[model samples]
Target chain A: MDLPLAIQCEGVSKRYPHFHLQNVDLSFEQGTVMGLVGPNGAGKSTLMRMVMGLIGPDSGSIRVLGHAMPHDQIAAKRHIGFVAEDMRLYESETIAFHMDFVRSIFDSWDDDYAQVLLRRLDLNEKQKVKGLSHGQRVKATLVLALARRPSLLVFDEPTTGLDPAVRKEVLDEMMNALADETRSILFSSHNTLDVEQISDYITFIYGGRVVESSNKEDFLDGWRRLRLTNPHNRPLPDLPNIKEAQQSGQIWTVTVNQYDDALPAQFTQAGLTVTAVERLTLEEIFLSIVLSAKANIQMKVAS
Target chain B: MSTSIVPQLVGKDLRLLSRIILTFVVVSLIFIAILAAIWDHVPAVVQGNFGFILLIGPAGTCGIVMLMKTNVLEKEKSTQAFIMSLPVTVKEFTRAKLWVNLPVFGLFWAAISAVAFYFAFARGLFPLGGVPFVTMVFLGGFVAYTCILAVSLVSQNLGMTVLCIALFEMATSGYLWAIAFLNPISQHIWGAVAVWNPTAVGIVAAQLLVAVSVIVVTLLVQNTKRDFI
Candidate 1:
C-alpha cells in the first residue's frame, strides 16, 4: 500500500505587485520529512502560508490531509501544526495559558507530551511570553504546536534565530515526533546543514519556482564539482548538465548536476583530463542551482 | 467556518482580556460614585453637562483600549499569525473578535447608561427632559465604537484604523454640539417632562441604523477576504 500524501499543491500561483510565484507543483508523502531550502525572498514563506491556508492561491488546487484548501481550511488546519519564525503568542499571557487554550480547542492535545516537551525544551510554563527570551518564545510556540499531536507539522524557519544547542534540541525533538511513522513534516529553512541532517527529501526553490526536488541521497549523489586540465588551452566542448564553469589558465572547474561514473570518460573523450572530482555538499549544490537558475533567467532576458 | 472553534477563540480572548476589562469596570464605577457624591454641590447645568462627560469617560476609554488590545496590537505585535495558526478560518476569527469585543463594550455602555439614567430620571437629578439627549449621547458613543471596530477589521492597517478613530471622535464632538445648540432636539432639554420629538427620535434611530450597518458591512467584507496575515 502506498502512503497517502500529507500535502499536494498543483499549478499553484500567487501574484503580488512585485513578485509572482508561478506554475508550481509540490507534494510529499506522509511519514517523511521534506526540507524546503531557499534564499531570501524565494517564496518559501509564501508557499508555506498558502499550505497552511493562511492565504489563498491566485489559481491552483491545494489539498492538506485529504481536505481541500481555503474551503475546508478549518478542517485541514485541525490536523496541521504550523510554526513560523514571526509567529508570536500573547505577550500578557503565560505558556500555561496558551497550552490551556490549545487544549480546549484540540481534542488530540496530549498533556503528557506537552510536559515532556516543556522539560526537554527547558520552558517554564508559568513564565509570561513577554518575559521569555527569543529562543524560549520559539520553543514555547513549538511546544504548543507539537503537543497537539498534529498529523502534519509545517515549520517555516523554526530554527532561524536559535543558538546551536537549542537548534539541536529542536531538531531532535522533531525527529522524535516522527517515531510513530505516520506523521509528516514540511519545513523551510536557509540552513542547509539542518536540512541535510533531518530531511528525507530535499527541495530547492529559487526566484519563486522549484529548481530541484528529490530524495536526500539522490541530491547528495548526483551533484559533483570536477576539476579539469587543458594543457593546450583548447576550448571546452559543450557538456550536458554543466551548471557552472570557471576557468583559470589551464584549469577549468565545472559543476554538473547529473554526476555518474561515466562523466569522467565523457570529459576525457572531449580532450580534457579530469584532475579531481569533488562531491558537492547540499549547501554547495543549493548555491550552484540558484546561481545557475539566475544565470539562465539573465541569459533569456539578454536574448 | 468552524462554529465550534469560534467559541474556543472567544473564550481565549475573554480570558486574556479579563483583567483589563475588570480594571475598566472598577474605574467606571468609581467615576459614577464621584459624580453621585458631587451631584448636589455643583450647579444643575454644571452637574448635568460635566457630570455626563465624567460618567462616559471610563467606558469610552475602555472601548478604545479593548479595540487596541484585541485588534490593533495583535497585528502590530505579529500575534495575529499565532492566532491564525490555530484551527480557525478568517471568518471564525472575525466572529470571535466580534463576539468577545462587542459584548464587553456593550456591557460597559449599558452599565454607564443605567447609572446615568438612574441619576437623571429616577433620582430627579437632571430635568427629565434631558433623558432623550443623554440617550442620544450614549448611543452616539456606541455608533462611534462600532464604526471604529468596522474600520479596524476591514482595513487592518494601523494608520487607517487610527485615522478612523480620530475622524469618528471629531464627528462625535461636532454632532454633540449641533444637537445641543442647532437642532430642534434641544427644545426638549429643559422641558418639565421627557418629550419624544420627531428630531430626538430620528437621531436615535439613525444612530442605531449606522451601528448595525457598520457591523454588517464589516462581516461581509471579512467574508470575501482571501488573505489575512
Candidate 2:
C-alpha cells in the first residue's frame, strides 16, 4: 500500500525584498526521511518554516499530515516536532523545565523515552540552558522534540555547528527515531554526508529553487562524471543531462545527471572516446547541481 | 485534540518568568513597607511624592522587564521559534502573550493601587483629595505599559521596544508636570474630601480608553501578521 504523504508543498512561493522562492513543489511519503540539502540562503529554512506553519507562503498551498498550512496549523503542529538550528529554549530554565513545558503541551510526550534519551545523550536535566554548550543544547532540543513522539519531525540544520562525534551522535539518534516506521522526518542541511547517510530521499535546493529531488539511490545511480579523450580538440557533442563540462588539454571532463549503461555507447556514437565513467558522490553531485543552476540563472539574465 | 494551546503557553511563560515576577513583587512590597514605616517621620506631601516615585518607578521597571523577557527577548534569542514549534498558531501565541502580560501586570498594578488607596484614604495617611490625582497617575502608568506592550508585540525589536519605553516615560513626565499645574486638580490637592472634577475624571477615562485601545489594536494587528518567526 502506498503511504500517505507527510508533507505536500505545491507551487509554494514566498517573496522578500532580496529573495523570492518561486513555484516550488515538494512532497514526501510518511515513514520516509527527506533530507533537504541546500547552501546558505538557499531557502531551506524558509521552506521548513512554511511546513511548520511559522510562516505563510505568498502563493500556493502546503499541507502537513493532510492539514492545510497556516489555517489548520494548530492541529497539524500537534503531530509535528520541529527543531531549527536557531531555535532556543528559555535560557535561565533547566532542561527539566523545558521537558516539563513540552510535556505540558503535547499529549504524545513520552516520559520514558525522554529519560532514555537524556541518559543516552548525556544531558544534565538540572543544568540551565544558558550554561550548556552548543552541542549539548542541540542534543537537549533534539531530545525535547523526539520525546514528544511526533508523527512528523521537521528539523532545519540540526547538526549545523557541532564536532564530528556530536554530529554522528545526532545523526545516529535521528536514525534511531526511524525505528518506529510510522514517523516521517524532513531535515534541511548543507552537510551532504549527513543527508546521504540518513535520508531515503534527497532534495537539493539552491538560490531559492529546488535544483534536484529524488530518492537517494536514484541520485547515486543517475549521476556520473566522464573523462573523455578529445585529441581533435573538437567541440563536445550535445548529450542529454549534461550538467557541467571542463576541458584540460586533450582530456574533457563532463558531468551528466542521467547516467545509465547506454550513456557510454551514446558517447562513442558521438565520436568521443570515454576514458573513464565514475560515480559521483552526493557532495560532488550537490555542488555540480548548484553550480549548474546558478550558471543557468546567470545565462537567463544575460539572455 | 483541538483545544486551544493558549493556556499551556501562558502557563509556560508564567513558569519561566516566575522568579523575576516574585522578585519584583517582593521588592515592591518591601518598598511599600519602608514607606509606610516612615509615614509620620517625613512631611506628608514629601512622603506622598516619594511614595508615588518609588511605586511607579519599580512598577514601570517591572512591567518593562516582563515585556522584554516575554516578547522582545523571545524574538531576539530565537526562543520564539521554539514556542512556535509547539502545537500553537501565531494567533494563539499572540493571545497567550496577551493573557500572560496584561493580566500579570494588571494584578501587580491593582494590588499596589489597592495598597496605596488603603494607606492614603482608609488609613488617613494622606488627604483624600489626592485620590483622583493618584488614580489618574496609576491609570496613566497602565496606559504607558499597554503602549509598551503593544509596541513590543508588534515590533518584536529590542531597539523599538526600548525606544517606546523611553518615549512613553518622557511623555509621562511631561503629562505629570502639566497636570499638576491644572487649576481644577491643583485646587483639590490638599482638600479634606475627594473631588471628582470633570478634568480628573476625563484624564482617568482617557487613560483607560487608550490602554484598552492599544491592546485591542495590537491583537488585531497580530491576527493579520502572516509571518511570526
Candidate 3:
C-alpha cells in the first residue's frame, strides 16, 4: 500500500500578531483527494497558502511533488491549479479574452477541452467576466484551471455561495477532473457530505491543529451508535471501545468507536439488549469529532 | 521556459494603470498645448521656467499611482485569496513591480519632456537649448518618482501615504540645504551636515544613488515584510 506522495509538510508554523498556526504536519499521496475541514478562521486557508508556496513558513520545510516550496513554487505551480470561491477574473475582459490570456502563458492549455467545459458549465464564451453571476464566475475559473490539465487541483470552498444546482455541477466537474488516475485534488469545506461523497482521505483541522487524518472508509469503520435498555440492571462490561455511556432511569444509550464481532454476544452475556447498531454518516461524524476535540482543548486549557 | 509571470502580472496591472495614465496624458496635453498657444502673451522667464518644474506634479502623481495602487489592488480585492493562490513569489512579484514601473514612469517622463520641448521652442523662435531643460525634467522626475516609491512601499493607507511624502520631502530638503551652504543659519550647526543641499553635481550623484538604493529597498521590502498576507 505504498502510495507515491504528492505533498508533505513537517513542523511548519506561522504566526500573526494575535493568532498562531502552530506546528502543522500533513501529507497526501498522488491521485487522492484530501478534504480539509475546520471551523472558520481555523487556519485552513493559512495552511493552504503555505502548502501552495503563497507564503513561507517561519520555520520547517515543505515538499510538494518532491520540491521544496516557496523556493520551488515556480516549478511546483506549473502543475498546480487553484480556485477560491472569490475567483479573481479579469473583470473588464471577456471570457474568451481570458482563455487566450491564460492559453498564451501555459503551453499545456487545451483549447478544445476548455470549450467543452464552457458548454458543459453553461457559460458563454463571449460573456464579460464582470457581468457573470457568482456561480458562473466559479465555473469560469474552474474551466480556466481545469483546462490547463494541472496535476494538482486545489479548490478552496468552490461551492460556497453557489446554488444547489451549481454546486452539483461543480461537484460533478470535480469528479470528472479526477477521471485521470494520476491527478489529485485538495479542497477545504465545511460541508461534510461534499467531502464524504468525493474524498479518499479526510483531515479534520480544529483550532489550528489536525485532530484526525485517515482514510475516509477507515474512519467510518469501527464506530457505532447504540440504544439499549437498563431494565435488567446489569453492570456493563469493561469494554475497551466504549467512548461514552449515558443512562437515564431505565434506558441507556452507548457509543462505541471500536467495535468487534463479539460485541453482541458480550452484550447478551451481560443480560442487556442491543436494540440497535446504526452507522454514523460523515456529517454526524463531523459533529461528534468537533465536539470531542473542543472538549479536549478545553480540558487542556483548564489543566 | 515559463514566459516570465511578470508579463502576465503586468498585463493585469496595465488595465488599471491605463485609466490613470490616460487621464494624466489628456490633462497634460491640454495644458501644454494651451501654454504653447499663449507663450508670447507676457510672462516672466523665471515664472515660466518654474512652471516647467510643476509639470512634475501630474507626471509624478501618475507614476506613483501606477506603482502603489497596482501593488495594493489585488490585496484590496480579497487579501486572503488573490496573492495566496498565485505561485508568484513575493520577491518576484515586488521586484517585477519596482523594475517594471520604471519604464512606465520613464514613458511619462518622456512625454513630459516632449511637452516641455514644445513649450520651450514655441517661446523662443530658435536655438532654445534643450539639454538643460531635459536634464532638469529627468532629474526632477527621478527624484519625485523614487521618493514616492520608497514611501508607498512601507505605508498602509492614505494617511501613511501623506506621511511618507512629508518625511521624504523633509529628508531631501535637508540635503538640498546642506549641499549649498544655504547654510543652516544657526550655531548648533551640524544642521549644515553633508546630507542636505541640492547642487547640480550632488543632485545628479544623488539621483544615481537613489536609483541603486531603490533596487535594494524594493528587494528588502518585498522579501522582508508582506502586507499581512
Best-matching candidate per DockQ: 2
B-chain TM-score of model 1: 0.92
Quote fnat for model 1. Answer: 0.89
- CA shift of A287, model 3, Å: 0.6
Tens digits of per-residue lDDT, candidate 3, A77-158, equal 8878888875577677688977876676678899999999999999998999889999999998899889989888888888
Q: What is the lDDT of residue B218 in candidate 2?
A: 91
Q: What lDDT tens digits, residue by residue, belong to model 1 across residues A101-206?
A: 9998899899999999999999999999999988899899999999999999999999998999989988898899899789999999999999999999998998
Ranking by lDDT: 2, 1, 3
Worst 10 residues of 2 chain A by lDDT: A231-240
- DockQ for every model, please: 0.79, 0.86, 0.33
Runs in model 3 lying further than 4 Å from the true structure = A1-4, A232-249, A263-272, B45-54, B79-87, B117-141, B150-159, B165-198, B225-228
Evaluated at residue A169, the lDDT of candidate 2 is 86
Clashing pairs in 1: none
DockQ of 3: 0.33
Q: Where does the lowest 10-residue lDDT sum fall in candidate 2 chain B?
A: B52-61
In model 2, the runs with Cα more than 4 Å from the true position are A1-3, B122-126, B181-184
lDDT of each: 0.89, 0.89, 0.73
Task: Tell me the tens digit of each residue's lDDT in model 1 across B74-178.
Answer: 888999998898878888888888998899899889988998899777878768888889898889989999999888777777899889889999999898888
Q: On a 0 to 1 DockQ scale, where is model 2?
A: 0.86
TM-score of model 2 (CA atoms): 0.96
